[model samples]
Target chain A: MDERLLEILEDIQPEVDFETCTTLIDDHYLDSLSIISLVAELEEEFDITIPTVEIIPDNFNSAEKMWEMITRLSEED
Target chain B: MFSIVTYFSVEALLLLLVTALLYACLPQKLRRWVLLLASYIFFYSISGKLLAYLLFSTLSVHHIGLWLADVQNECAAQTKGLARDERKALNAVYQKKQRKIMGFACFIHIGLLVLLKYTPFFSENINTLLKLAGSSFKLQIPKYLIPIGISFYTLQAVAYLFDVYRKKIPADRNLMRLALFMSFFPQLMEGPICRYSDTAVALYDAPKMRYDNFVLGSQRILFGLMKKLVIADRLNLLIQNVYAEPNKYDGFIIALSAVGYTFQLYADFSGTMDLVIGAAQMFGITLPENFKRPFFSATISEFWKRWHITLGTWFKDYIFFPVSMSKPMKKLTTQARKKLGNHYGPLIAGAVSLFCVWICNGLWHGAGWNYIFFGMYHFALILGGNIAEPVVIKITQKLHINRASFPYRCIQIARTFILVCFGELFFRAEGLKSGIKMFCKIFTDFTFASLKSGSLFKCGMDRQDYIIIIVSAILLFVIGILQEKGIQIRNSIAKKNIAVQFAVYYALILFIIIFGAYGAGYVPLDPIYAGF
Candidate 1:
């Protein structure tokens, strides 16, 4: 899941190193536009809805966090 | 019964001191009451009968929050143990109901703000249209005594309601907590636009005022005072003159005033934030910061993120993401991405939402065409940056430029500053037309004759005044650099001896007293953001 998530993130912003790097939002690696693209891709790839309420930095700051959120949200779904 | 014009005023300081004293002496339960009472007193002192508007907003937000919560609770109870399809059906029904309530809540809260703040602007536009249509009818524009902090607190009210509807936070049952959150005196005037999750519980807890907190809070307040009195107010002399009679000066002077107005705004607004956060700190409550050395930003979008940070977050959360992530926009993003590739795909929808954000951002500042133009100006800048990002990246890479290198970042920062100063020019201009004329004069009538003849000092700032402003600016810049580098000056000072702390405090006081723009011949700038 982490690998898949990294793929999606890199697809959205290839310049960023999604594995080791956190602070994606904090460091401006993934801005609002990136978030928009990432959200749409994550929903389609993972078959889970990404609600706006969960669009905070903590959830998308890293690939690991993104995977955690995806798994948790998928289970909830 | 006395009125206080700003947090910088002696009356406000006295009020804060007296309240802090009362809060410290009182029992824990009574401290919250003291805060509530002091908040009401501060509101009444400013707007008098208009306090009713704030009271009405508080009560309505409290009631609507609970109403939405009740629906959510009911939906949860019914949805339990149901089949997935049936549960989804019930959830949709409840969401629709809650959405209606949220819409109505926004109508009551944001509607009041629009009516009170924008009625005259709307009426004048309509009258112009009526005239343009060759009609004799003129709309009778009514004057409104707008409540103080209506703009700041209305956003708070709407944010609270939205949070409740979204289930980000449980609906706060205690009206007193909600009331305090809504009307917290320090932030009620000009906000960092705090969230319920940020300060509500901390305020209700009303921690005992420790000596360190008191001293630290006082130090912060004094720092804010220096920023306001020494810099923002001093710059006011030039800014007010150039902006008022923009036609009186050449573009060089106009450009200087634009830069002056931008710095004045920063000092004024950020200084007020310092006072607000400091006052909250005295009560052992912390408010979110509204600024992060915005001038250091390398892009207009980055500038917005760093400046008036809370308001930007509010628009991002409430306006930007919601609009962009809406069903149609999401679908637009999905479809566009497949066709246009990753970056430009989401940008189409992002631009749509960005436009909405900037329009609200502009009008949220005030109800004027210039404010709208200010919003659109940034919107265009941000959107243009977005469009040019790929090209810039390609060019920089081809040119062997390290985008993250110091010299390149410096150029970016300088470029962003010039753009921001122009935006502030429009923001501070009398109206849209004046802003445009001043902007045009920058190119058409550009010259340094005023500086060559030494007549530049005569407008409102003198040679001595210019020197003082320059020295103060350098001081602020050093402090900003330390802060950006993660040096906590206050905390570092706190670790020092008591004598050192007091010396720092007294130096700030004496600085304001000596070079401050208060005595005769200096008309202090009014609280700029408070009007917004």
Candidate 2:
């Protein structure tokens, strides 16, 4: 799950080092379109639905935050 | 009401000088009110009785903002000791009240915009429908006296309300600061819509004026004027002649106008931004920029990201994200993903949100069918791009072509440029039917003679005029290329000796005075986006 999150991050925006990166949206490394594509890719790979509300910067600003959200949501499912 | 066309008009120049002097003389704490007063005075000069609209926006946002904040505070206070589920219930109740306040405020602002700007268009369409149905009743189309900068101000107001509701920033307690954000005179004409969080601090801080800012601002204004006077205004003559009777012209002429209009629009809008941004800079405000040499974009999506950058950001924050996250959209995503594979699933929601965005974007420009078509056209291109991404990547990898190669990048830029030109053609055309006809003529009315027969020369410009335009355009293109490479030309030039600086300024001034298509018979176009 951790590797997958980093994979999506670096694949979409190569400059972002998910380990060190925070404020992805603030810096515009993850623009709205990139978010859309990321959501699609994540939903497919993890087989967990990431809805629009879950797409906010708080969840996706870092690989750790993203992993946390995905794990929690996976448990809910 | 002072149309920005009068950047050199005596009254405007005098007003600006007076405002600057007043700002400089005022004490630190009192300077904000000076700006607020200056904004209202400027608004009064242009909008007259319509100054009431600015006051109304200020008052409503001010009242509703406080109301939202109060509810939030009260909810927090009342729910502090409650059990978990009870606290959740209390928070939900507070959320509903906050939503109501936001909704009411949005309704008044958006309703005013729709009633003033769109009623006539909707009335005219309804009357057409009535006539088709053989009904004798026909509604009268209203001739609305739309306040200057209403669209821009309304959007700013909307952004502020959304931000407050989302708790992105605490709702501003000060009414005058909120008012100043909405009516900042420089941006009122055509906006790089200033969000409260983005610009309000700079505006209220009343930073001490620095000579560097003034010089840089003046240089930016000079570049802006050069673009407007030398290129956009000059091209206006040829565009008017070609578009007035487009069918009379051939394919090459229409194609030329398409390309010309694109250049003309960039020069006009970016010129306006430079002028306004420079004006803000003089006050040490550092307003956000609206353009970023969008022609260099390698994709339509990227072009939008660069062009009218604030509007794109505003929509993304206010419309696109909210819509994508709404319950119905989430459901649509799930269903689409299940039915069509995961690849296409999330795009379903994004597309639906983008659809709403483009439609609003089109309608926001004006109550015109062509503008609406322009919006949908872009929406189509962007959505098309999204769907084609994987296939493109696959093909590129299979062919072993470097996606980041220079030649490949140029091809993409050219392709996006042509697509944008076609979109701009519709945007600028007189009507939907005309835009369609003009587009059709591009394919049907072939003319190799337009290139060789010297017909292009006779349109509305002589040889000297064309030469001046070409030279100025080349200069702008070079600047654009350098800027794209992250070169700071203005800062670089500012480092040079006083003699070099004066020489550069003097040359631009001379070029503008000698060859600019204005001053005698030329009609200064109202800044194009001002109508919106």
lDDT of 2 at B24: 82
Candidate 1 C-alpha lDDT tens digits along B1-532? 8998988888998888899999999999999999999999999999998999999999999999999999999999989988867877788899999999998998888889999999999999999999999999999998999999999999999999999998999999999999999999999999989999998999999999998888778788888988899999999988888888988899899989989989999999999999999999999998998999999999998898899999999999999999999889988999999899988999999999999999999999999999999999999999999999999999999999999999999999999999999999999998899999999999989899999999899999999999999999999999999999999999999889989877887888888899999988889888999999
Off by over 4 Å in 1: A2-7, A14-23
Clashing pairs in 2: B1-B46
Stretches off by above 4 angstroms in model 2 are: A1-61, A65-77, B1-8
Query: Best by TM-score, which number?
Result: 1
| Per-residue alpha-carbon lDDT of candidate 2 for residues B169-195, written as tens digits (9 for 90 to 100) | 788988878888998888887898888
* lDDT per residue (tens digit) for residues A1-77 in model 2: 48877886676667667788777777766766567667666776786766444667888777788889888767533
Candidate with best DockQ:
1
Judged by whole-model lDDT over C-alpha atoms, candidate 1 comes out at 0.92
Instruction: Report the interface RMSD that candidate 2 achieves against the true structure, in angstroms.
Output: 5.9
The CA lDDT at B394 in model 1 is 100
